[model samples]
Target: MADKSNKFDEKLPFEAAIDKAGYGLYSYIMTALAGVAIISFVCIVFASTIIVPTSACELGTTGSQQGLLAAGPVVGSLLGGILWGYQADNRGRRKMLLVSLCGGTIFNLVASISVNWIMLMIFQFIAALFASGLYSMSMSLLSESVPMAKRNLVVLLVSSIFLLSQGIMAALAIPIIPLPFSFHLPALGIYWNSWRTLLVVYSSPSIITIIWLYFMQESPKFMLVKGHEEEALKILRVIHRINHFRSKEEFEVLGLQQEAGQEAALTSSVKEQVAPLFKMPLLKYTIIMTALFVINQVGAFLVWLPTIADQFVRIMQTGENSDLNMCQIINTESPVDDSVTPCSLNETSLLIVLGVGAMQSIFNFIISIVVNQVGRRNIVMMVTALCGVSGILVNLIPSALGSAVVFGVLTLGVVVVGLYTAITVSLFPTQLRALAIALAMTGGRIGSFASIQILNLMLVNSCDAGFYLFSSLFAASAIVASFLPDDRRGKVAALAKEETHKNELAIKTGND
Candidate 1:
């Protein structure tokens, strides 16, 4: 259909043509759309952080059970990350994303109506199984779709969608949870309160996201690599036409084209595609990225920061113990009062939690704006170092501001994840990109799983030691970040070019 522009693809690869198409309204629109999907997924993961404990009172959940509720989504992600990653690489990112987001939202609604704790847990697990795919696949689609020059800041901002969701959740929860409303269904023997209502309120965006993706095209570069040259060029023109409305008449790319001899390797068996990530320098890249993710996830300051907001305030107000540590302040029991009704809010505690989330979200947006100038590696190192110092000060200085610094530093982990995602997306070919990210991010998942267990063991019995452990890990990760090449300026794109060239050569030689 893109007859006039088909020759553009023949003469110049889709990747290069896309670079020529450059950043425009269409690119930003897709960025916003993809960011929304990420927001939905992150909302599901974290919304439970608030909803679980709130429901625990009526649900008769023990502290351990509450922990499980918080971790349920992570467990689901651990199980599905690799599977979804592999699917996106083989099946098409847009298709996998639709399946993930739509499917997750339906089950999240089911979870809201869950009659029992086990039922809710099971529902959440199922929801995460689908939702988890969106995070990894969204990165693939956005990084590949956007131009190289804009990707670092773009991916950083997009990855920060989770932080943004936290802020939104906090802002929305205040009014919604305070509504003082409840809905009960006798047939199902269920009673719903403001907390449960919050789930549907927050998660409803996934429906909008699904509808958006329904009209959105797959990554044009992705289509080109898989032999859908016509479709790819068509998408490129649509993009150009959107961004270049006044000059639409001048849009004359002929069609999608691979480099010379690239057409032969358009198709690949799953194994042929997956095998490369495990071999060569790609393996090294995957390992380092995974480690960084692990550190970020293990020390998920943002998640635990809210839990400790009240505690941090308490310590700061009293200045009681010079020896007190972060885990002592943060990793504590549930805020539930058995004397009160289930799923009910403790006004002060709830507000504090919400406020912390809102503040963190705002900080994330500020970081995204500044990261373009500061450079990602510097941000990672600077934050990790500050986190370590905050860990020490939280122990030594028992001040309110000290606790705030720790909270703010924890937020940096989100930035590191964003930077890693942006860089890694550039380093791999499209065929293996999803799986590669999934595998790398799986490190963070595993780290989260371990961190929870470790914190549980150490936070209460040995606070100072726990504080040192987390802070030291961040310190170590900072050193690691120092070694990671800063690819904010076309480094990933350069790697992608080489990989594309490699893919073309393999296809031309019939090696696949």
Candidate 2:
């Protein structure tokens, strides 16, 4: 029944097969799904910034306790990122994503009913443990689903969605958090207020994401690498049929070319799978990505953007100290007396947060357009260097509006995160991609935690010194970005060549 005279008799590489499948409705839908997954994670992590100040009175939380509550998700992610990555590599991307999303959503729902700050923190922490690896898993699956040419653009589009998530959160929180409704449950000794309602709203995205993922197929490239040739082919055929509006049989890729030793990775232990990244050529990439992550994660300052914006707005409204810098304005803030003060959300601050997210989202979209022409390495260097200069200018300007604009530029570090992630996907093999990304992000989270702590100390002790320190980190990141591969294609080709050599050596030894 086979067409013996068909011109495409030879097997093709997976990337080539993806090209033949073409990009159409399917790629767009998948990229959107990936963006939703990102939103599910982003909303949960950032919801804390809003929840902390709003819930402080009802939860009876002290300053230190509120700090712990704010940090709960970060700590949880720190513990769980590598574990989920390991499972994703050994099992499958789709499975781990489903498992994590479901678990995270369930815990998030439970957290909404929490009566105490400790209860809320613990539940959210557990939720974050489940959600920590969603970003990397989503990126890896998206990377494998599309053709090589569309990979960077689609990945950055999803990153744009990530930036947009902040605005979405602020928009949702604005109306929901200010509602003058409360249901008191005397039996449970708790009040179901706006903050609790906001938590429920935040969990909605994850619930929808889980359902969307259920209809999605496992990565065909993942199956091909694991030696499921028939399964992979079936998925590819469906893709071709949907994208090309042609018969599945017409897809010319008869078989997929698997990377050498990829199937062997199926049986390898986690330690065995991870060891190679530290040994030879991968060592340089691993080290460089870690350094980039450390510096990039300094964007964690955005976590306090709402708080700073609140103080800035208050100062401007009072027409007090009009010529003071950001540090001076922040120092003038009065501490909230949780025991006596009414919990109120600031509208101007929420609007500022929304503006920041919208601006960054636009910037990310612009970056996606230029990335192909400008190159990933170049963009990373250019953006970081520019943001570093902005970081210094943030403290130098005496006007609040000027400083705010510079602060926005400083947050462009978020754009670098997306670029670095796209690079990680191409830099590593399919078998190890998830784990490698997880490791790099874990480093980033560690950096984020340290920077937040150090920034808090510096902001209180020496505000100018704090800004200078982060500016230096951004500068250091730009220097390291210069070392990235001139072209990701060359790097991937070299990795493929190495894998082919290993495969040949294995075959020769078997024959001997």
Candidate 3:
């Protein structure tokens, strides 16, 4: 018996590498880096909904223009998700993440100084094109780097960046955008306003990303999948050194298993690669995850709370808010009056909304903490069900605070979306992992875009009907969550191997 464990090692080299490296300091470094990238991306994401339209008002654009501007990043993300996703699958995860973040920051800065609506949209579109890939790629990179035991919680840790980013943007915007600052240049055909300065401030995360790449390393598992066994081993040992606080420990595992005939071609066309995800077991998983993305629009509605809560205020308390809704208020066809800017908020209201966002962040963190104990599927279904019921409670209840409380509960549904991302990423192997996440998020990006356009139309008439519609969607998501396969227990790699073996057999039989 030369080596008995060699056969077991051959079958699951990736798992073996993970076993050797384990989870400690290396995992913490990767998790923190991924969280920062997510925070940077999310900083732009939150800005698009809140700050972009406010910028539109600052520039005196129309409702149609506002809708188009808002959709710019979502569309960029739609394309970037797929394009960068396929690239990450082939080129390497870490490289694509660095490229996307760097490029996104550059264009974000350019968009801040755009002369007109067209320039703003174009620059922002290009920014989105480069930046959106970080979303799915960072998730895969983080997942592959961490141990199986801590995967779900790690994903949540990265996702909590959204809440942190939102608060940071809000805190910055409250002070920056409200300034009586103005710089007009007729020669440049640009009238720079406080909103522009504030956007540049929000885009500061670009610098953060550049610094992150300095300390990070490429994922060893990705190297293994790409047929670099020696390089893979080298990286794993380095991770082991950092994690175990030692320099000279041998990793017993040789390498991750490579598919038969995989050396014949390093990569395939995007379609051939992505097709497997749409077939059999993987197909069902993709659909269920996409449904989660579609139903998570409750977070978007909550963004309108300031406008909604403003309706309950008496004229004596806060001047004429105009009987107009959020869409009408922000999307004025004429020049935005100097007297009332979007950021013209009383200190009381500003503090209250920030408090609400902080509260939602706390609940999301709680979900992450309990995810390991409660199970991923159980957590999503339970939270989304309550989110659905909260829709009804919002209507039955009275007072601005009552509706506000219900909407805050509904925001918890967004956290469930993060758990869904963690669950979805766990299902695919490295070859299809990033692409699967991108595909599922494509549905989400589409939903976000369509919802904004639809809400701009719906929020005008029956705001009550809007809440009911969102409620029904969340309820439907809970039903879909019921059908998703729970793969937390050593199933993803095994399933991928089985699927591959079945394909090879089918090919052999056809040739025979």
Candidate 4:
């Protein structure tokens, strides 16, 4: 029966292959991945704002020291991405995700009980490694499992949930800290700080994800390649039973059968599975998409919208009229003069950040709709150009218009970010998709790390220079984005097959 099913799939058209598999399975997998993606985003964004600020305040660390602490994740993420990507290509997505999530949960727990700043940094780096791995693997699995027609929408939807995680972190940070109970080290007799408490709270979510994922099945595509026909058929039957609300007989009628005697034929090794990714056509797309990924990362890093928003608030308070700059605001040396109402740091700035985050999700939804229609290259170029322009405006805008325009520019910048993110997901093939994304994301993290360091340096002198520096990075990203190719909508498998055929014919002709 398994053999018959495999034969049926081999004979079916590309679209038919998608249709034969149960969409319900894809949906379930994507839903799970989306949850993990959100957690990953929350962990990173939360660490940047809540953890860094609290740790720095507690330790009396300098701006540069804070910058290094902030960059710890990116440093770990770069290494983790390459390691996990190679693992996914070899071991499979489901296994890697579970491993990564479990690792992340343990590391975050350790981080929450750190003895010193050094231990805190080390644990954060370990947590980051797992988080980065989880992120890349989830997206790659989603891409491979979904149909061509629905892939863009699914990828965008799954990725967009990461935005909501940021909001969740913000909401959680307020309540978790200043709690009555805190960890105390008997050896040192010092209670664990609020920052440590926050880490403990944040780490709780990963425990749920880790347990839930253990019950999940492997991707049908991965199973097929690995020659696990019986297991693949079982998964397909379950999916079919769920989707059609019927039994195994109904699933068999739908042509979800395994190929005859293909178990012996299915001898393709892991090396064989990955070798095509480096060959022609696939290799070309990989290079192009990787370059775009690097460019987008550089732009994303420089346009740290949250930090810029903070600076905007400071500038608004200090510019010409107010007596205080950021230092005075932080140190509270002089009582804020009644005549000068310091910009309210409550929901207003938070709302602006939320608005920007929402705008990014909205733009992602828009790209999901139009990506197949307008093509990937054009959308990237246009959005990247807008991003560059918005960065410049963000730098140039005087802080006089009371926070409203600051909010608007930041929101616009986020929209551009969404646009670029959508393009990145669409450009790579499933086999190499996760690794490509990891590399790209890691590159972006590097850019972000550099931006943070630069911002810290400039904050010592002038806040304005940081915004200008960010703008320059976006401008450079736009220049790089213009060179990418369009149209990543068709079947990657079919493309690979066609390339293989062409190569065979060329070799035959050369031999003749």
Candidate 5:
């Protein structure tokens, strides 16, 4: 058998040729796909802040009922992720993406006009089912398309851009859609309720993204594996044309001829592809990664702003010892009312959260540059440890200094989030990539659900215990990080191939 590390062993000639066209076109396409994925994050992160509160007010929902409404999308995402992963791996990433985006746009548009909580929940779930596909497919497609040397950086960049989109949505949710059209839409029969209007605006990106994706080609590697040599060649030709500004006719002729020869020489059995993923070596690595991801999700859920806001408020009050009240903070008024008294944080907390989000985006961008150089394991370890430290400080700080401490802790949390995003994208093989991401993200969703429940039960009663619980989860994540293999800078395909060979040998010896 050929050494799996050799690029020739894994990629067909035509597949390699696509990468030769230049990184610019490839990077652009990845960024576009990544942007689509960000819509899901934006919706999920801002739901409690911008969507749920508005929904609760407009629908006259009880607090417990509001919690269920908030959980609708995540519940939908958990199921959608698993379904989309199977579809993405078996069908094609491009097809999955088109279907997901188009469906999401329609669902979100409908959600904007929902008459009651039931209708709203149903539409939100439908939207999530489509939106969930964006992240898993994007990671799988980008990981398979790029060169091994540049793969980590590309993945990091994609994740960073996705995070940045969340910040953009946060900024826009308050000032643009909710504020400007809040009253104007009532005359137009639109009833520009905060959450409804936000959904309407959020769906706008999906419309443009779906249209753009329609013109994009499928992954060349996916085409080759599925025996669509001509289709793969046409895609390669287009890429070459885009990168070099060559005549499409000339590139098509060259590409088809090259792909035809390569296809004849390369043959991979289905068993070879499927067997290694479930056997030893690969199985071991999968278990370790899955466990690390599950632990990471726990911390991720705990650190989310909405999940801990009530607890942080209590800490702020204790520190300030002022008559800062939540009752006066109405939807029409600013978050902070200076006329009453100075509290721990009012409108400044919003700014602090935005600043933290911006800092997260910047850190993620830097991680994109340094990920391939420093390697994945070291970065994960360092970031996980820092997150643990921050989580502890968020709870330990005195009430008077709580706001400052919370801001600093949030900054560190953002940095950790960037690192986790980079590492998750780099940890799986192309064939199993979507499944791996879905599984990890599903873990996060589960954590988010549990954290929400904890908040409803515990934080509503004793807020301090909630912070301690969150901090403990962060510490556990650091412990899990220490168990992961140091394969950050390595090629996932090469690693998968090597593990396959070892598992094959072990099976043969056992039979003998």
Candidate 6:
């Protein structure tokens, strides 16, 4: 048979073939593209946090309305997460990402021209509905494309970009939102101001991501698992050629092995794609990861960090020397008029946000460097527990500077997001990986939406309670993270075990 002829040369396991592909420029480019995808998704979701405040005068947004606007992306992403995950597993990661990015960008552009806060919220929700695919799928594509050795570091680095995006938005806002230019549109009955202009600028990453991803290859692992071995081999050859700067013919990976127990036929139904994650071996990881996501994503402290910073600055501006805990400082009546007027962001608050983002990004990068050595499980436990302690400390800190520092530490929960993602990639099988992440993210989005809404109420009535609640959540997360399987070696052993099980089943079937 032609298959026998194809096997004339030595073949490699999937990981071996990935190693043979070599690490080089192509790998760096894939990592960069994945980072851009993170920037796009993070900016799109959080853009309203900045825009709602800056545009308060023009949009006539109340505090409650602003909270709802902030929740829109979470709600939309929550709704779309499972659907996008199902499609990504079924349809292919690259193709679905292109569709989602293009669609999200178009809707995001439409959001810029909105006449009112409600319209803006609606459009942003729709945009997030499309953009939701980027969350898990981007990680899926990047993890599958790169060699396994670089996988954890590269993924964490990209997650650092997610943290950096807040600063990116702040840096972008520093120049753009303060621009003293406005144009009135008589027909639409709204003023075209810097905030609206900023939304347009925010959409640029998705545009750039779409263009880059269009030229890139589908995850070869996905291809291989789906029984397109020839196509997968071709991609590996291209990777080898580009990585080594050598001819494709010199790449001697003549064949690739299917992952142990990989389903050759694509699962056509949503149930088929999702069911595996809830059964037997994968179920425990799903439960733990989802719980961790829910706990970490209770974003009350983080969502309100900027507002607290701005409030702290305002309080200090009044020459009040009395040291106060977070609740006291935030709840203290400021001497200045708090009314929405001609829009402006405090330079100090902007700096605080930028600083927090910068610190987190650097920390994430450092984690990327040492993660392979320290191990993902150990890192997750330490960082998450640190976040819990910080959250508790944030409420106790009386000094403005101290509170800001602790808030930065509290926000370290963002780092855990990346670790959980890396864990999920290693924990789940290729066929179910995207869907499993999507399901976990669905839990996270719900947590975010609930946390934001709950915090809105708590920050008004009981600020300390909100901090205590989130700290408790983080404490719980750290406890759960301790149980994770050693990701690196576990993945290899799991594959070999599955292969042995399959062989035994075949032998038993043959005896019958």
- For every model shown, the clashing-pair count is 8, 0, 0, 11, 2, 0
**What does candidate 4's lDDT look like per residue over 1-512, in tens digits?**
78877644444432345455556754666666556655754574346555665555455667666677777766677678777887785678888887887787788777877666677778888888877777667766666565656666776676566655555665565554434355668985556766677787787677767776677667665565456656656666555566556435354333233332223324435455445445554566455555545544332332334454444454455554244433223223322544422322233444546655566666667776877767656666666566555544543443445233432443444333444444555554334456656666666666666666666666456655554555555556556666655455564345445544443333233223
lDDT tens digits, residue span 178-267, model 2? 676789989888988889999999999999999999998888988987789889989888777777764444777778887666656766
RMSD of each: 3.8, 3.3, 4.6, 5.8, 6.8, 3.6
The list of candidate 1 runs beyond 4 A from truth reads: 1-10, 259-266, 310-375, 486-512
For model 5, what is the error of residue 3's alpha carbon versus the real structure, in angstroms, after optimal superposition?
30
Give lDDT tens digits, candidate 6, residues 1-512.
Answer: 57755644566777788887888878888889999998898678778777877878888888899899889987888898988888888789999999999888998899999998899999999889988879799999999888877888789988999888888888787778767688989988877888889999999999999999988889888889888899999998788788888544466677887655565335335554555566655667789999989988535565665666677777888877457777788788766555523556766777777887899899999988877667788888888888888888886876866876777777877888888898888777777789889999898888889999988888889888888887878877778988876544445457435633543243233223
Error of 2 at 239 (Å): 1.6
lDDT at 361 for candidate 3? 70
**lDDT (CA) for every model shown?**
0.70, 0.81, 0.70, 0.57, 0.58, 0.80
Cα TM-score per model: 0.87, 0.93, 0.86, 0.79, 0.78, 0.92
lDDT of 1 by residue, 352-447 (tens): 665655555566677678775676777778877776666655556554455556645554455567767866776666666788899887778878
lDDT measured at residue 341 in model 2 versus the true structure, 0 to 100: 25
Off by over 4 Å in 6: 1-9, 246-249, 264-268, 335-341, 487-512
Give the C-alpha lDDT of model 6.
0.80
Worst-scoring 10-residue span by lDDT in model 5: 324-333
How far is 31's C-alpha from truth in model 6 (Å)? 0.4
What TM-score number comes out for model 2? Answer: 0.93
The number of the candidate with the highest TM-score is 2
